[model samples]
Target chain A: MRTSKKYIVTGLFLILLIILLSCELMLGSVYIPAQNVFSVLTNNEHQNEVWNTIILQSRLPRALGAIIAGASLSVSGLLMQVLFRNPLASPYILGISSGAGLGVALITLGSVGIGFTFVPNGLSLVASAMLGALLVFSIVFFISLKVKDVMTLLIAGVLIGSIANAVVNIIQLHASALAVKTFVLWTLASLDQLEMTDIKLLYIICPLTLIGSFLLSKQLNALLMGEKYARSVGVNILLSRILIILFSGILAASITAFCGPIGFIGIMVPHIVRIIFRTNHHKLLILFSVLIGSCTLLAADLMAHYFITSVSLPINAITALIGIPVILWLLLGKKDISKTI
Target chain B: MHTILEIKNIDVSYKQQKVLENGSLTLKESTLTALLGRNGSGKSTLLNTISGFLKPTKGEILVSGVNIYKSNPATRARLISYLESTPLSPQNISVKELVAFGRYPYLDLFTSLSESDLTIIHSALFQCGLSQFSDRFFNELSDGEKQKVFIARAIAQNTPLIILDEPTSHLDFIARREIINLLKTLCLKENKTIFFSSHEPELCVELADRFVVTANHTFSEVNKTEVLKTLINS
Candidate 1:
């Protein structure tokens, strides 16, 4: 029987999430009082100009950016885990991020000869990243159809990653030092420099994609077993797989497009939730993954925000510090995850 | 006896290699049938075809006297549940939580668990002797315990017919007999038709109400006594 304690744990997690998210909004470079923050939120006409700009222009967008990035990456990771039925599988595992890096490279290199005049200089780079993520998504999706084995798909993913890295390096070699620096900075994956427009675009896309993922929770849970098991459970394997890939592509592409390719949070949050709740219940996992992801990213973002007085660290660096250890612990515990194959 | 399933002249292939040719079988309501076969003998293939996981190249799989291939898969799942030989054990899931997944076919999208669904899950856990271990992590359980948890999930599906591939392979001899007896009790008490493939020919003959033997990629029915004899001779 379910207990009151379970409800308490869930409530506690929610409270922790709220505290972290609020701290994310309040604890930036220019500090604002709690009362002033509330007034800026509610009394729009009466608030101070500096407070209004900080809350509206800087803090709100940054908080939203962190949320969108976190949810997308975590859910993307969850979907890949189900699609390949591997604990280590993630959206970044297929080398899509590296491919997106290549796309960003092409755009940053100032290839005016390429088509699409509608894309302006900065936006073109983002679009190229999206296209790169899409291309990688298609390749991995296609390979999965041919190879039923998860390990084979992983091998293919590694091979694709290697090839994509080679291409990215080739692009780097031809580009100028300044462009290479710009590309390298982007690859570090930061949460800063998010404009209001970028926030709006993410707001529009990420939630819609997340809703689509929510609808496919049962299907994803079924896929945790193999395809035959999924089908026997009444899941349409083809349709579900397509939807998963599509949603995952949007999330991965969005993060890579705006914030660069951040890893670990995507791959780690679902595993964390699985460990906490002791269930792959999609309904629970889907909801909690978003929450845990937001909390994890916000905590990491805080570290990035306050770690150095002189300079802010990239978000991915903080995540790597936290995530790698959990992974190491899982591996060292002898869980026999690889034996699933 | 009312017929629940009919497999008519089924020919199945994996890409180009033919796996099952003109395979056919019929199942009556409230019967327990054991599927016996060697490795690569198309036993799992037949189960897949029958469950609508794979469409046979040339044949019809009918469930509840309706061709399952024609019925939309969601509806077919409402009638049949198939457990794979080596299913992925969700690491963090408890026995109770995994069994609750069986209600997926009954509930609509966005519909949370109703009281009936909880009741079914509770009963399944009880039947599979997992009532006491409902909170234990699935990965922490022994292989025999995990097999019972899987059976509990199938039981929670609440379908009239259930299919399993090699359900007893994970258990020791004593645990194997206990699971077999548990399955037999389910068939008798609930009037649910059960079908599972097993390598233990003697166990199948002793336990199952009917025997379905797959030899040389072909399936045929044999009397329990004859199946026992065949096992001895082979």
Candidate 2:
């Protein structure tokens, strides 16, 4: 009976994702017709050049970016929650997003003080963000070797994140008006600015890492019982821990490098999936998180773009608006939220 | 009777402080051995060392003539199943699903649970009197029922020797008796060599076939009457 329920929910999410993706493509600022959107997507041609460009250039890449970012962040959150055995653990809990932000801040905000006035290109921005994320993650990994307690590692990550944010704020204080504006806008996070090349890079990284996480479902399930029980059942705890960290780190770093730290979705989507599916089994959780995560961000992005007449809200604002209430409801409900972890 | 377990003169330590020094014991096949010790008497340390969770500073442990420390984790898992005093209470896992974790050592990465595995899981649940509660969530069960579910998981592992640390702690008098009785039945019916540590010697006195007492950092086998006296006097 549970297996059939899983199938039905999975099928429903797939259809929901398709509908959301279509709405994202069709109901944008200019409001292209459904048939015109379909023709533009299929034949790469439309009678109206403006609508064609809107569909192919702006809407298409943004839609794909939302899907990849949503799926990557949600899966990363799920891995962190299981790895740390804490429900509040999200992809950004380890400070990788803060590291990425620090990197972007240094390039965009710090460069002003050093008399470099040029706008940083996309490639350089990605490289610096990735470098910062890896640097922080490597430090956490090193500390994990000596600590032997996951709670300590979690505290260390929080402290490291605070230190990185402090440095970013100091740089922001001295930056020029233009540079500070650029840094602030990046922190707000927008899915609409990703180029096709950026989307392609995300396609390569996120799917491979997500597949790797899926293959580790059995180990994750065993670990839910605790490390000792997992080891007794023949799981190599060290190897599994390293692999989980590496996979979640890469996913978070790649998305943050491109999308400027899209928040709330990473922490919120897994809880929603767990509540709906009513199982902690990662095999089912990972698959459904990917689908539902995609649908959620697509819907959020559609609202961010079309909610007002002509003004697009920041993606982060919309996600937090959606995320906070669900989390509040889960906490206030009859079921204890801590038990879910 | 064939000897199923052998512990040579092993020394165990916690944080560089020796807890047990030069300890040795042996167990026969299809027998239930109760470990009786006072608080902080190194009973848990000894059990952990035997279950391969801790490395002895100087000694060797053999299960059925093979050195356990020399084998891989999967091989050790096939040799023995261990239950800690307080296993984690994970949410949203059913009783049957938790028991199926026993087959993990036998499975490769790509293979799902086979028919034989399912049969073993069902039999384990039935033996533990948890068949009707198989669909219940782990946290929803009472302490006694949860202990049985954990034992059912250990039984489903299908190992020759099983080790448990304080299996009957924090239970009512009736639940304690029931757990001991269940352990005794598993030994007689399944022919498993069972070694468990417990604080309640009175509950185990009627059912335990053998008793080993941990006192003064060493292990000694004592008779039924002497074991109770030793525990009370300690």
Candidate 3:
């Protein structure tokens, strides 16, 4: 009975997400009728092949891309914040995303001028990105075992991230202008590159990871209290720590592989959910987070789409632009974020 | 009286600096215990060791004759509930939900509250006189009320033994008295073994049924008046 309100709130968020999805389909560079968008989505054959390709191949995947990317970034942000016990922690800022970016960089830059003409498709980049993220994740994961301090891991992640960034910069310096330009564009972060195949892959990884987070909801709740408090209550602190790092790493790495390092969704979305839901149940919070995160990136995608019809802006820049202010307001708005979680 | 807790010759050290050595003590069931010592007397360390957070350099702790360190966290949690001094009050959690975390040991990750689990949570809240405050945010409660919430969480754990490093360290005089009386009530009414560490030996001597003093690397029993005199002179 008490949970009825969360159901209503989540239901509303889902509705908002659907409405935004419809808007995304209708409001791209070439506007199609709301009716045609529906017919195409329902898998009905339309008369015009070009309009069908634009709808089925381009707009649909891009919109799904925004939804999955938003959800993944926000959920991982929630993980990082709880893991570090700091409200400011995010996958992008923590260098988790940069670790993925490094993976992309090694592949994107290293093969330059070698006459290796491999198609740099979404699947390949995603694989490279996942590899890079897992590499840094393992380092942080093992260190978490010895350190047992989230603050230390936070510092280590940032340091490892910086080292990775420095290395990427060196690679860029030696790389050809074309290679460097492509790497820079990837860092800008966009949803345009995602295809239906990439979206299908994410449909598996993202949902599974979200479910994994839901299963560990109790441990995350324990963690929000503090390590000693959690352990005293029978939570396996070390196991929980390792699992959290891996889960967040996988979530971040998957998104970075697909869409580059989309900034601030993780930090910004969880805070918004906290402010709205105002409850501490991670299961419920995770649900609210995924919904709100889905809506957020859709809105961000729309904003990027409409910012200038001539050329779209990077989704990463838009999220940071929106995210920084929300953080500022949360800190200044008497939100009581200074409490342990 | 049955021995509910046995701390056997524990040698606890922090970074090679031994704080307690060769300390052996047994506490009986249904008694209020106060661990008294001067500053840096290893009272917290001993409590943490007993709670299974710290492994002693050489000794084992037994809860109801079972070696706690050899047991799993969930099993140990069912046997003993522990509270740290100055516990962090996580924001955005209601007092009721916070107390429900106590039932964690009995339930799995996917299990929702059964009828009896809800009953126990309500009882823990009722025992602490927090029925009206159950829905309030834990961080918004007053200092004394917050401390009672912590105790209520431990109570809801339904463990035989509850250990606290310092429950009243941050309370005012009236709050301190209220907490002491509450602990006394828990021992009497609920028949729970409540062992707590405190620097306030004078207040503790008046309240506790048993006094265990730690000084000069040893633990020895003392009477109420003797505890007061020893703490004052030392």
Candidate 4:
């Protein structure tokens, strides 16, 4: 009975993801018809050249970016929560994204102050972002080793994020107007700005790391009981910890490098998946998190694009608006949130 | 019965401070050994060292005549199953699912649970008298029930030897008696070696086959008469 229920729920999530993906491709500024979007996607000859260009160039890449970012962040969030054994843990809440943001900020804004005229290319941004994320994650990991209490580590992550944000703000103060503007817009976070080349890079990095996370499911299941128990079951705790950090760091860093620091999706999606599935098994959790995460971001991106006719709101704002309430509800509804994880 | 677990003169320490020095004990198969110690008496440390969680500074532990420290984690896991006091009660995990975690060491990364693995899990549940509670969430169970679930998990691991830290600490009187009886059954019926630390020596004196007391930074096995005299005096 449980097996059949899982299959049905998994199928439903897949269908929802498809519907959202189609809506993301169809509804946009120009409002291309669903059939036209389908034809364009299928490589059929469309009558309107402008519609084809918009569907292929703008909507397709943006939709794909939403899927990648959503799945990557959500999986990373689930990893963090399990690793730390804290329900509030996520890539954004633990300051990993801010670390990536700081990396991007240094490259984009700090170059203006240094007067080096350095070009912020895709490779440079990705490298810096990953370095920053790894740096913060290493600190968090070290702190976790020293302190058994996860709440302290959460606080440390927030403080580290604050420090990174402060550094970004200081660099912005010294940067040129153009550099500051670009950095600010990046902080607002968007999916429409990613080029096809960037999408190709994301496709390589995110899917491989996601697969890596899936492969670690057994270790993760062992970890769900705690470190000592996991070790008793022959899990190499140190190696598992390092691999989890590496995978999550790369996932969060690559997405932030491409689409800015998208928040809430990582932390929010896993909890939703856990509630819907009513199981703590990582294999099922990781699969549904990916599907549900993709659907969520696609819907959020759609709202961000067409919520208001005149002004295009930041994707960050829409996600925050959707995510904060869920977080609040999670906090208020549970007397002790840590028990839920 | 043959000696299944042999601990040579081993020193256990936390950081640089030594806790147990030259601690040694040996246990035969199918016997229940109860470890009695006062608060902060290094019983847990000794248990951990024996279970391969801590590296003893100057000795070797052998399970079935194989030096456990020289073996890999998988070998050690198969040799000994350990249950910590107050295990985490993870939410949304069913009793059967948690017990299935015991089969992790036997499974490769890509392989799912085979028929034999499921059989072991079901038998463990049945042994613990938790067959009806297999579908319930772990966190929702009462404290005594949760402890049984953990024991069931250890049983599912299918190890020859099992060690537990303060197994009856938080349990009520009836629950504690039930647990002690259950551990006794596990030893005699399942033919497994059981070692567990406990504060209540009186409750264990009736069922325990042997007693090892931790005091004065060392461990020593005492016969029942001596332990009874000590208990009566203290």
Candidate 5:
């Protein structure tokens, strides 16, 4: 009976995902008919070359971007919450995005655009962003080892993020006007402008990291049991901590590297999954989180693409617009927020 | 072997402040022992040191003749299971799932429960009278049931030695008696060595086969907790 219910929910989610995907394809700036979307998807000989270009080049990547980036961010959020044992914990609060943003700022700010080198410019961003994120993560990870207090470690992470943001602000000031515009535009592009190559990298990195997180589910659950309690049950605290941090870092960094630092999806999607599923089994949470995340971003992208014909709403704006109210309601509700954190 | 756990003149300190100084004891097999101490008397420190969670400044603790501090976490876990006196109850976990986590030390980084693991978990729940409550959320359970779940988790761990700090401290007398009864049953049936700390000396005298007490930074093995009570007042 339980299995049947799960199947029904999964089926419903799958249908929603497909409809949103189709809508995403049909509702871009240059609207294509729903039938054209079907032919284009099936690779039938559609004579409309413009429809073909928009679907294959722009809309296709954006839709795929929504699926992967959304799933990655959401899973990252769940992992962060499990790791920190804090309901409010997410990649945004931990500032992995800020650190990656700082890296992007450094590269885009000046003449040494390594993208001009043998490595693809997009690939360069990935490396720099990953590097910056790993650096900050290492700092936080070390602080976690040294400082036993959770509040202290969280405060230290916030302080590190502030420092990174400070550097980014200085870079914004020093860079040329074009550099500033590039950075600004990059920040605006969440799950858009993802080159096929970057998408391929994401296919490899995201699933690998996500799988790593799933494999660590048992350890993650142990962590929720309280560190001391977890250890008594034979959890390798150090190993689990390192793996959680690494997985979260890689997931968040890749998303930021490819699609500018998108906000709130990472924080929002997991809460939605938990609310919907009413369970915290990591395996189930991870699976549902992925599906719901994909559907949400696809829906959000559809809205962003079709919200205003003249101007496209950025994905970040759409997510925040959706996220803030949910957050406020959660706060206003009698959820005993302290117990969760 | 008569001795299941041996602590050899161990010293524990935090921030260079000594908590337990020159503590030594031998825990016999299949016996229920209670560690009695005042607040800041280092009952927790001593238990932690024995469990290999805390590194002592000096000396060794051996379980089944193997130096626990020298042993790896996995090796130590195989020999002994531990429980903290006060733990933040985790949410969204079922009693069964929480008990299944006891198999953690045996499984890989990404653990998969085997048939044997499942059987062990069931037996643990059965022993704790929690088989019916397997699907119940941990936080929703009563305090007494929650403590049993902790013990059941440790029981499923299947170690010869179990050390708990203050398992019955906050519980009512009935709950306290229940926990002691449960521990006594575990000792008799499983032939396990159970060492638990408690503030209530009278309760310890009623249930424990042996008593270890802490006073003025020293841990001394006492034949009876009442004798130690008299010594403390003196």
Candidate 6:
């Protein structure tokens, strides 16, 4: 509905959303016109069978993929922001996604052809990613316990990320061309190949995870006042933090498992939500972030596909292109905001 | 009245650097004590140790006659509250939401906010002049308003003792006076023992019931007469 600024923002977001869905349905290796796209989307079964197959088997799932990855990554981003209490904190900066990647490498690339039969399979790869994310989460968490400092935890997360990157690089060195190619392709990142099964998986998981995130609204609200205040209020600081981190890790790992470490959406969208709404109320911020994140990723996905021919530009590349400007805008804006500390 | 917090022979250090050596302080029920010190003094450390955020090298902190360090953090939090040097960064939180955090100890994990919790939150907001700002985002509030929001949170916490680390550093002249007045009123009206560290000796000498002068790694009590003498002599 056309409406006021808030609804307008929502409408613009939805408009962008409709365009993105259409782009996803219409553009690919084969270009289906807008009409044909709509026809197939509706119940007109007489559309070109091949184009219809591509639309049903490929485009719809891929569009749904973008939506899920976007929502999941953004929620994790919001969690990182609250957890660290730093506006700049995000899933990518904290290296949570990279941790997931390392898990994938270890389980898939790292364990390939090795003698340890217990390294597990596809399920284990997901488990490994979750485990990897949990490992970093725990390390950061434990260090937080010892350090009692937010900045130290941020620095430690960076170090953890760098270490994970180094390990990933080492594994990449020994990987087979096929395995390495798979990893690289996944790393280049795209939502193009998402199957209906993956979409269903995300649809089921993301809503539950997001609800859990929203349920922590009061806890997160308390955290913004500082940890001590939260403790004073009877929030078991460790338990609340652990819950937030675990929730963040699950969302990050789940998205990374399917989307191959999509970037910048997790890093930038939350801030945009905060800036636009100018509120730290977690209930509003959480929902706004989810919508903006989904829209932003879908828009980015559409651009990644249509902007070039033959080879799709990585979705990460598209996000960085958009995300960096926002970062610079925030940096410029910081001078005016007076961020003491 | 039973002692709500006991600091006995505390020796806290940052690695090799000793911050507090054999430092000790006792907080009794229904007492407001000012922790006065220079910048590098260990006032913050002492407060943190009492609140179970840090460990003393060779001492014990007893809350309600129980060693606070021996108790788990959650139980200890319910007994004593510590505010840090600066208020935590504001996420998009409202005054009402911030105050509700004080009810956390009473509420189960993931439990819905209860009627009693709402009563506490409302009273806290009303007590701190934050009722009008209940739905306003924390960041949108001025520094003075934010400080009040935190005080409201502590009030809602309903703890017997509240420890604050420099609650008025960023406020202007009028705001500082208002906050100090508010805190003193809380002590008298609620019988909540307030312990806070401040560099402002004149403010302490004027406002506090009893002031603890922490300097040169030692502490001493300054009674009302001694407080004036200390203020003039220093």
Best by lDDT: 2
* Chain A superposition TM-score per model: 0.88, 0.96, 0.92, 0.88, 0.88, 0.84
lDDT of 2 by residue, A1-341 (tens): 38888888788889988988899888967888888888888876436988878887889999999999999999999999999998889998889988988998889888877887758887788888888888888988888777877788889989998899999999989988988888888888888778888888899989999999998988999999999898888888888888888899899999888887888888889988888877888888898889888988888898899878487788899989977887678667636788787
Docking tier of model 4: it is: high
Clash pairs for candidate 2: none
Winner on lDDT between 1 and 6 is 1
In every candidate, what fraction of the native interface contacts is reproduced?
0.65, 0.63, 0.75, 0.75, 0.54, 0.58
TM-scores, one per candidate: 0.89, 0.97, 0.95, 0.93, 0.91, 0.78
The lDDT of model 1 is 0.80
RMSD of 6: 5.2
Q: How much lDDT does each candidate structure score?
A: 0.80, 0.88, 0.85, 0.86, 0.81, 0.76
lDDT of 3: 0.85
Candidates ranked by DockQ: 4, 2, 3, 1, 5, 6
lDDT of 4 at B79: 87
TM-score of chain B of each: 0.95, 0.97, 0.96, 0.97, 0.95, 0.92
DockQ winner, 2 or 4: 4
Cα lDDT of model 5 by residue, B1-234, tens digit = 578998988889977899878888888899999888778878888888888888999988889999987877788888889988887776666788888878888998644899999999999999989999998878889899999999999999999999988998688889999999899999999999999988778777888888887888878887783656654762
Residues B21-65, model 2: lDDT tens digits: 888888999999999999899899988888888999999999987
Candidate 4 residue A16 Cα shift, in angstroms, is 1.5
- How many clashing pairs in candidate 5? 0
Looking at candidate 6 chain A, the ten consecutive residues that score lowest on lDDT are A332-341
- List the lowest-lDDT window of 10 residues for candidate 4 chain B: B225-234
lDDT of 6 by residue, B41-100 (tens): 677877777777778888787777778778765677677877777866554455676677
Which pairs in model 4 have colliding backbones?
A: none
- DockQ, Cα level, model 1: 0.54
lDDT of 1 at A52: 89
User: Which residue pairs does candidate 3 place in steric collision?
Assistant: none
